[model samples]
Target: MILMSPAEPGRKFIDSPAMTQGHGTVSLKSRNRNSRQLLSSSEDEQYQKERVVSPEIMCSLKSRIANKQNVANVTRNQLSTSHILDASANMTISKEKEERIRRQKEKQEEFRKHLIAKQQNNVSVDNTKNYCDDTALLTRRDLTNTDENSLLTEDSDLLLNTTKPSNNKSVIIVDSREINGAQDIVSTLRFNHDINVVAAQLDSCDYVVSVRMGVDRKQWSEFSNGTNRAKMTERLLEMCDFYERPCLIIEKDKCKPEEKGRILHWTKYVDKTLVHLIQSKMTLFFTENQLETASIVADLCQLENRKNCAISCPINLNTDQQNRVKFYRSIPHLSYVHCLFLCNNYKTVASFLCSDVKTIMTNGKMTEERASNVYNYIRRTFDTQMLPSNYG
Candidate 1:
């Protein structure tokens, strides 16, 4: 109803709009300002609370971060160490495998050598008159005295019968490799000529005639062929190095009657080779057949016996002794016989080196020329600057 007049600041009214107001009067502008101020103050107080932090809390947080990093580093280190260990283990395993393989190979080699020796013994037993005769030759370890009489293993009768002296029954040492190819020669030497044909493992020759002489038998075809010439030359040259008298027996190829006329004739190459061989100081003998070759061999054996140049008893040298022999063999014009003599006389390389030229000549059974050569060779000065570029 009644429209009341606006109340004055100092007046009081009952049931009026002014009666609902508080004792203090306020402007709308000021009230709005106050509300805005309260909101701003509350926001500032919340932001301060959020920003404030304790030193202990900050340190703990930092420590947690550091601990995580340390843990990561430790894990990385462990992984690296494990990898290294694995690599070392693999290396050790590989080394062990290599060692095992090497031992196996060595065993195999030793076994192979044993088999070869056994086979050689069996063959010698079956072919020779007495097993002990040949075995004694191999078993005699004392090479200090190389007397021919002491070395002879045959029954004294076989060697010293007045009717059939040692000269009449000559001994020829044939290479084991030649057994298959030269069966006829072996048979003829044994049965026909009554010669003691002993098989051995000869490195440089098919037949060892004496301590000084060795023979290599070659067929005419091998001698004439261009392909085989180089190999044959090298072999013959090696033989020359091994023996004082290296002989090559060129046997005519046994062809059928129809093929006899078609046999290859000696070419210029053959003549050239022959000239080269002669120049090398190698002896050559031509034979019509194996029978004739056996006769020639028998004749050679008899001649060597007469000259007291019989073959020495074969001995199985150990590795070191064999190497020593090889070193001795390297000397120019030194024969295998002389090499064996040197080895037999000297127990050690030092003793051999200490010996004078005279002692070397006596012990090695070498001529003055050969002994001088060996002595000079041992004492020869080796100057690297004076050597050719290709020199080994």
Candidate 2:
């Protein structure tokens, strides 16, 4: 055995050759065997050192591993909690968006409905204006004719052509309690020379009937002590039953009842009374409520006649009447002119112009010469200007 010094750190140990080696050369097999023995010893020593650990170091290692595992678990839990929070936040945002959208849709729907109603109201007003214009044109044409006698005959013939001749005389039943000088107005009309007008008290007349002027709340209350409105109504109906041609005139203002449905209820009552009376020749009229002037009352009385000529002439041709006619005629002419310019109705336009001119002549507003000139001028304008280019 040869003595060997302890190897230095990080240095490999080298074996010295023994004196028995031949020619100072080591055998390859022997060297390989020695190297293997050295390597085995080192491996055994490393294994023993690894197996012989202290209790404190082992416990420290175990604690360190446990801490690492706890940290990993905490990280996983935090990630899961963050994911849940993100999901809840996303849901809240989505709900808010949905709510806002719903509100926006509702607002749009409301605006649409309001727009439609406004348009309908505008259309109704326009239609009414057009109708008034047409009626006015007809009246003006009749008034402005040059040949009064011929026009009058023509109007009579036209009227007669539409209706069969009747022998029934014009009889008006006068209500005893007329208001606002209505009685005096009716009295004047009764004496007029134009028509064979006959007037009788409400109780005596069968065809035409007029109610007292003060049918308002105070008058109605005083008439029957506010006990029964139907009582006065019943009395009026009974008076109307005796006539062959029954006509009922009610004051426009006084016909209203205090309660909403009372008027409707009263109307039903009147209707029922009429049905019971079995009178087929019944006519109803609602006149102006409050008449301040006698002329107004006279005008109303004229309107009461079945003939259109009844109210055509003003009671007195004062500035007021002239102004009224001019104002009334002017509005319709404006509308008619507008219609003429836009519409292609030459024959109808010519007839309307002729009729208005005739009416003006009959009313003594225009001379025959002036009426004729107006008729010709309007007719020429209608033919030349208002007519369509294609229309002959």
Candidate 3:
């Protein structure tokens, strides 16, 4: 207790070992408990701080999430719209293709139907011909030996009987010699009036007739205007109009190779003249085979009321030869008939058919077999009975 050595202010000294140990243990436990409680309090404070957020930061996060969701929605909608447009375009293309195919099928069907109808008509005509042939054997009568001349005379008389006089005193003047072999056609007509046939080359006339046989390339080139054939044609047309003459232009059906074998009008090479004439009907145009030219000329002459004397001719024939004579006589009579049958141009065909059979045969250079074939073909092709009785 004496402060002899005041042991460094209040230093404690253990009196008993058990007491010291119990006190130390208690102090250590208390310190550990205090450290645990402090740690738990700090952790709770940290958790609370982490949980709390600023209002601005919360709004920004929400906006960012909302923007992401909107972007996703927009992208999905664009993809859907693009798919829809693609599908619509494909559908439209498909529809057009289908429509075109359908139209083509329809045209093909129509053509097939037309072919079938044509075939049926041909069959019907054949059946009718057979029926007529069977009936003719029983009712056919014997006929006199009438020559071609007699038949021609009869036809002329028949035509004269039916012709009505016209006030228009139009005369058809011709330059028969100008066209090669065309004189034969004019001579065959045997016009009642004084034929104004001239050997001189004429500039303009009522009728300008020309004939072409086969493909004449040089002649075609000459007419194709190296020297202005179109201008010449125009001038001719104008002259005819001024003179108050009916213009008849006759050309052969044959043309040059360049023309593709089509029987074009003479004025076709003349540019606008053809269209003008057609629209005005100022000129008569004819494109016929060389063989048919005589028939056309004869028809025109007969229509003009030209008088021709009938020639009476009789050929001596036996009972067996009577039919042959009749058949020969029928050839000339069918001139006008065949003309009308072939082209339906009554005047032109009549004039052509009225040509002398001998002249036609010579001009055409046709053999008997070929002529018969042509005649038979025409009779088979057209409804011959539909023609006037006189023509038939």
The number of the candidate with the highest lDDT is: 1
Number of clashes in every candidate structure?
A: 0, 19, 8
* RMSD, candidate 2, Å: 24.0
Candidate 2 residue lDDT tens string, 229-327: 566556554433322234444443345455534442245545565474355444544444433222333443345444332212112234543443343
Q: Candidate 3's C-alpha lDDT?
A: 0.44
TM-score of each: 0.49, 0.28, 0.26
What digit string (tens of lDDT, one per residue) describes model 3 on residues 1-392?
74535665433445357768988999999999999999999999999988999899999999999999999999999999988988998898889889989998999999999999998998687556544642342233113223533433444312211111122222233443435645554554335333333232233442422211011111233344436756655655544332222344445445567877665435545556446556653455454443355455445544434332111111122464444333333443222112212221112333434554432322222334434544554345667788788844
Ranking by lDDT: 1, 3, 2
Model 1: per-residue lDDT, tens digit, 1-392?
65545665334463357754642355666888899999999999989988989899999999999999999999999999999999999999999999999999999999999999999987665446334433453345225445433433321222211111224456677899889999999999999888878776666789987777899999998889999866887788778766777898999999888877785696899889889888877889999899999989988888887886775433446888688889887777676666766775567777777666766665576666777888998888898798788856
Instruction: List the global CA lDDT of all models.
Output: 0.74, 0.43, 0.44
Candidate 2 lDDT at 139 equals 60
Please list all clashing residue pairs in model 1, or write none if there are none. none
By lDDT, the better pick of 1 and 3 is: 1
Give the Å error, residue 29, model 3. 1.1
The candidate that achieves the highest TM-score relative to the unseen native structure:
1
